[model samples]
Target: MKAVQYQNFGGPEVLEVVDIPDPKMFADLVLVRIEAAALNPADLAFQSGAADPLVDSLFPVTPGWDLAGVVEQIGVATAGFQPGDEVIGFVRGQAMHYGTYAERISAEPRQLVRKPRNLSWAQAAGLPLAGLTAYQAIVHGLKVTAGDTVLVHGAAGGVGHLAVQIAIAQGARVLGTGSAASQAFIGSLGAIPVRYGDELVDEVLKIAPVGVDAVLDTAGRGSLSTTQALAAVGARVASITRSSTEYEGAIDVYARLDGDDLTRLVELAEEGKLTVHVDSAFPLGQAAEAQRVLAGGHVRGKIVLEIREEV
Candidate 1:
């Protein structure tokens, strides 16, 4: 089996494709032949040593969380899936190791759900990490409800695009912040586009003078300024990237892997209410380059590593 591994924390240049033995399928875990793996900002941060303090790395590590693949084997106790089933997962364990960027991965059944029938392998691979972030932030963290006006920072990017749809599905009126170029994409998701910049606060204010009922900051760098200004009294404002503890009256959400929670997202996609836009894809061996692209931080949607031929 071939997998992307890094010996020391650094840049994308540190990654290399190496041949390793097939994963030892363990009891209580499902073994899948990798099809597609999606890149996320966290993968870049962890690789660049920024997230090292929070993660305990064992030197050589495969990097990725989002995955869509075909199940080849399952532990004796695994009940929901059989060989040949299609699945998707947020395949993170207790620490950094044995990720989805490889040709195979053994994931805990609790972290996976059946792939949505409507999605291709690339789109399914893009769903777990990014979709879960938006789903949890909007449905749980912010508690957005009908008639509420919601503001999402970086709303045209990976998580934001799905967050807009999740909010709209729940009947909330959404306003998303992005560059002027993303206005049309944001609008297409049924959210009012508010261009982000020095004028961000003013643009949001112009749309909702009374203030927004909820704010989800998918964009991490210094987004608090805009979020705080648009939040109405008692609004639940939260961020996925930064700690809300640093900001007063804000929430911080860490995306968790729950097969059950992901089912709702799958259902939405199958029903045509949710979709993943693949910003770009690189061959499995080009994992290093894919990390570099995502690290640039201006990506429009989920970036993926394609292992199998596109479906």
Candidate 2:
């Protein structure tokens, strides 16, 4: 199998595609022939060694987590999936290695979900990590409910855009923050678009009046700091980018691989309540270029690597 791997930590420059031996299947893991892989900011952080202190690294690391693929082989102990099943997964583990960047990956059953029939491979590939983060933050962390006014920072971004839609799906009135360029895109997701910067608080207040019922900050840059001023009394707050200690009451969320959670996202997508937008896609050989594009920032949605033409 051909895979993208980096022997040392650096920027996109460190990545290289090489022919590697196929991964061996463990008793409890399913082997997937990857069709697409999505790039995330964490992929950049992990490749740059910024996440070094938190996770151990295996040299020649294959950097990716979000994947959409077809099952090529099933483990003896894995029963839910069978050969030829189409699947999507967040393949993270205790260490940085054996990622989904390759043509094949062996994943635990709990990390895999049946890909939504309505989504293409690229869209499905982009759903796992970002979708999980947004779903967990808005639905679980903030507990957004019908009639509530929710505020989402970076509303047009990869995670933020999904967060906006997820909040709306939960029946919350959403106020999403983004740049002038994104206002239309933000509003299209069924949220009231609020511009970023000095007037953000005013913009949100103009719509919510008494302040938002919950705030989800997907864009860091001191976004959590505004929760005190933008949220209503007793409002919940969650941040995927900031630290819990950075803001007194905000919950700092890290996305986890949960089969149940991914399945719910798939249902949302199937029901047309959630959408995964792929801003761009590159062939697997261009993994490094894809990372650079994501690192450049301001991406409207997920960037994917098309591993197979049929995808």
Candidate 3:
């Protein structure tokens, strides 16, 4: 199988397309012929060796975390999937010891969910990591509810876009922070778009004078503090991007790909309550270029790598 691998970490140049052996299936894992995979900011951090806490523990890595594929073979103990089943999920960050930038990958059964019939491979590929992160931050971590007001930072990016829709689906009045360029796009997701800069707090106040019920920060700036200051007393505030300072009244959330969460996200997508916005697609051999675009930031949505011609 052809795969993207790097023995050393530096910049996007460190990533290279190479022909590698296929993954061997474990008893509880399924061998997937990868159709598509999505790139995340973490992939760039991992590749550049900046996310040392997450990448230092592993080396000679392949960096993709979200994948959509068809089961080429099933493990002996895997019960819910069979050969040819289309599935999407977060691949274990560690096993990508070589990453999802490959033609084939072996993932644990619990990490995957059936791909929604309504979505294309590109859309499905964009869901796992970003969708799970948003779902967990808004639905699980913050416990967003109907009639609540929620604010999402980086609202035009992959995770932020999903968060906006998920919060709206939960019946919350949503607000999202992005640049002027993405304001209209974010508005299409049912969120009141607030430009993310000096006027963030002021703009939010104008929209919800009483303060919002929850705030989800993905920008990793000190926006969490701003949100805390603007939130209603005892309101939920969380950040998927880890915080440097301990927040007194907010939860710092980093999403994990669990069975239950993946299942629920899939259900929401299949039900049309969730949307996966794919910004771009690259062929497997151009994995490095995919990472380059992701690094430039301000991406409208997720960027995916097409691993198979059919996908």
Candidate 4:
């Protein structure tokens, strides 16, 4: 089996593809032949040692969390899935090792969900982490509801774009912030586009004079600083990029792997309510380059590594 691993944390350049033995499977696990693995900012953070103090890492770390693949075999005790099933998962383990940036991975049954039939392998690969982030923040954290005016920061980003669509799906009127160039893309997701920068607050206020009922901050770097002015009194506020402790009245969100939530996202995709836009797809050997592209920022959607030929 070929996998991407890094011996020392530094940059994307440290990643190397090497032939490793197949993962040790157990009765509680499923062996999946990975077809595609999506890249996320956290993949960069962990790889660069930015998350060292908070999360422990084994030296030779395989960095990836989101994957879409076909089941090559299932453990004896595994239920709800079988060999030949197509699945998607956010398979981040307790420690950084044996990630999805490989030809195969061993994931728990609870972390896997049937891939939406409508999405290609690349698109399905991109959904789990970002979709869960937006779903949890909008639905659980902010409690966005119909008729509420919701504001999403970084609306053109990987998580923000999905956050915008998820809010709309929940019946909220959404306003998303992005650069001027992304206005049309933001609008296409059924949200009013507000340009980023100092004018962001005023622009959001212009659309919702009473202030937005909820604010989901997908873009960190002080993006939540405008919460006081942009959100109405007692409005729900959440940030996936920064800690809630850093911002008053803000709930910090960390995406979790839940089969139930992933199932709902699959339903949304099947119903045409949710979609993943693949900004780029790279072969597995180019994991380094894919991470570099994600590090460049301003990516319109998810970037993925095609681990094998799409079935």
Candidate 5:
């Protein structure tokens, strides 16, 4: 089997596709033949040694967390998944090491979610991490509901786009912030688009005279003041990028892997209520190019590495 590995933390140039031994099936874990993998900003940070404090690295590292694959083998203890079942997984753990950017991966049953029939392998590959973050932040952290006005910062980016859709699905009247280039894309997701910057607060206030019921900030350029000013009298605020308490009165969210949560996201995608945009895709061995695309930033959705044909 072939996998992308980096011996030292540095740039995308460090990524190498090498022939490695197939992963051994561990107890209580299922083995999957990976079809596709998606790259995230955290993958770049960890590979470049920037996430050193948050992620303890084990060298000869394979850097990826989002995967769409088919079950090749199931552990004796694992239930609910059988061989040949199509599945998606976040594959994140307490430590960084072996991952999904390979021909094969072993995952715990708790990490598995049945893929929706409507999604292609590329779309399913993009959903796990970004979808999970948006789900946790908007649905759990902010408590957005029908008739509420919600604002999503960085609404054109990966997680922000999903957050916008989830808020709309919950029946909230949403106002999303993005650059001029992304305003139309933001509005297409059923939200009022507000170009972010000096005019963010004003645009939001113009759309909702009473202010927004909740604010989700994915752009961490000190947007606390804007969110505070745009908040309704008693609004919940959350930020995925700024997890520090220094931000004040904001719930700093970190995405966690939950099978149940992914299942709901899959249901929405299958029902055509949510969308996962893939900006570009590279072949499996071209993992370096995929990272380069993600590092460029402002991609409409996700960057995926298509490893093999989906069964």
Candidate 6:
């Protein structure tokens, strides 16, 4: 099998396309014939050694976490899946030993769910990590409800786009912050678009004078503090990008991608309540270029690597 891997972590240049032995399925896992995979900030963080502490425990790593593929073989103990079943999941943590930037991957049965029939491989490939992150942040962490006003930062990026939609689906009145360029796109997701700049707080105040019910900060910088300032008293606020810090009154949440949460995201995608946006894609061999695009950090949605020809 061919994979993009780095023997030593350094920069994106360290990632190389190489031929490696195909993965062997272990009991309670399934061997998937990789169709497509998506790039996450974690992938770049792992490749550039910025996430060294997180990667040290999972080394000689293939960088991707989200994958959409078909089951080519099933391990003896794996149930609810069989050869040729199309599935998608967050392959990290459970299949951390074998990353998604490969021709094949062996993932734990619990990590995957059937890919939505309505989506193409490229779209399905975009879902796992980002979709689950947004779902968990809004539906699980903040517990948003109808008529609640929710704020999302980086509202046009991969996770942010989905976060906006998911909040709307939950019946919350949504407001999203992005660059001036993404206003129309953010508006399409049913969110009132707020251009992020010096007057971000002013713009938000104009929209919700009483403050918002919840805020999900996808842009890690100092947006958490901004979210804190605009939050209602006892409001729920979470950051998928940054670690929690000393914030006076807001509830801080750290996004953790869990199997059960991924399952619910898959169900939502299948039910048309959720959507995954693919901003760009590269072939498996162009893993370096994929990392380059991801590093730019202004993508409207997910960047994917097409690992194999569509079935």
| Between candidates 1 and 6, the TM-score winner | 1
Better of 1 and 6 by lDDT: 1
At residue 81, what lDDT does model 1 achieve? Answer: 86
Cα lDDT tens digits, model 6, 1-311, are 78888877676788888888888767888998889999888777666766655545365677787889999998888789989999997777642356888888888887788898888888998988788788888988889899999999899999899999899989999999999899999998889999988899898989999899998888877777776668887788777865446345444555565777777777777788878778898999998988888888789988999876423
lDDT per residue (tens digit) for residues 185-247 in model 3: 999988999987877888888888989888888877776768655688778888877762546
Where's the lowest-lDDT run of ten residues in candidate 3?
51-60
Candidate 2 vs 5: which has more lDDT: 2
Which whole-number lDDT from 0 to 100 does residue 151 have in model 1?
90
- The deviation in Å at residue 271 for candidate 6 is 2.6
| Model 1, span 1-311: residue lDDT tens | 88899999899999998988889977888999889999988888888888777879877899888899999999998888899999999989778988998999998888889999999899999999899989999998988888999998899899999999999999999999888888998898889998878888888888889899998888877887766677788888889977576468888888887777799999999989999988899999888888878878778878999995323
Alpha-carbon runs more than 4 Å astray in model 5: 243-247, 309-311
TM-scores of all predicted structures: 0.95, 0.97, 0.94, 0.96, 0.96, 0.93
Q: What RMSD does each model have against the real structure?
A: 1.9, 1.6, 2.0, 1.6, 1.8, 2.2
Runs in model 1 deviating more than 4 A are 243-246, 309-311
Q: For residues 1-311, could you state the per-residue lDDT of candidate 2 as single tens digits?
A: 88999999999999998988889988998999999999999999888999899899999899999999999998788899999999999999899988988899988988898999999999999999999999999988989889989888899899999999999999999988888999999989999999888987887778887988898888888877777787788888889996555568888888987778899999999999999888999999999889889988889989999996323
Q: Across residues 104-193, which tens digit of lDDT does each residue of candidate 4 receive?
A: 999988889999999999999999999999999999888888899999989988999999989999999999988889999999989999
Which stretch of 10 consecutive residues in model 5 shows the poorest summed lDDT?
Answer: 241-250
Stretch of 10 with least lDDT, candidate 2: 242-251
Instruction: Please report, in order, the local distance difference test score of every candidate based on alpha carbons.
Output: 0.88, 0.90, 0.84, 0.90, 0.87, 0.83
**Where in model 3 is the C-alpha error above 4 Å?**
53-59, 93-96, 244-247, 309-311
Q: Please give the lDDT score at residue 152 for candidate 5.
A: 86
Identify the runs in model 2 with alpha carbons over 4 angstroms from their true place: 309-311
State the weakest 10-residue window (summed lDDT) of model 1: 241-250
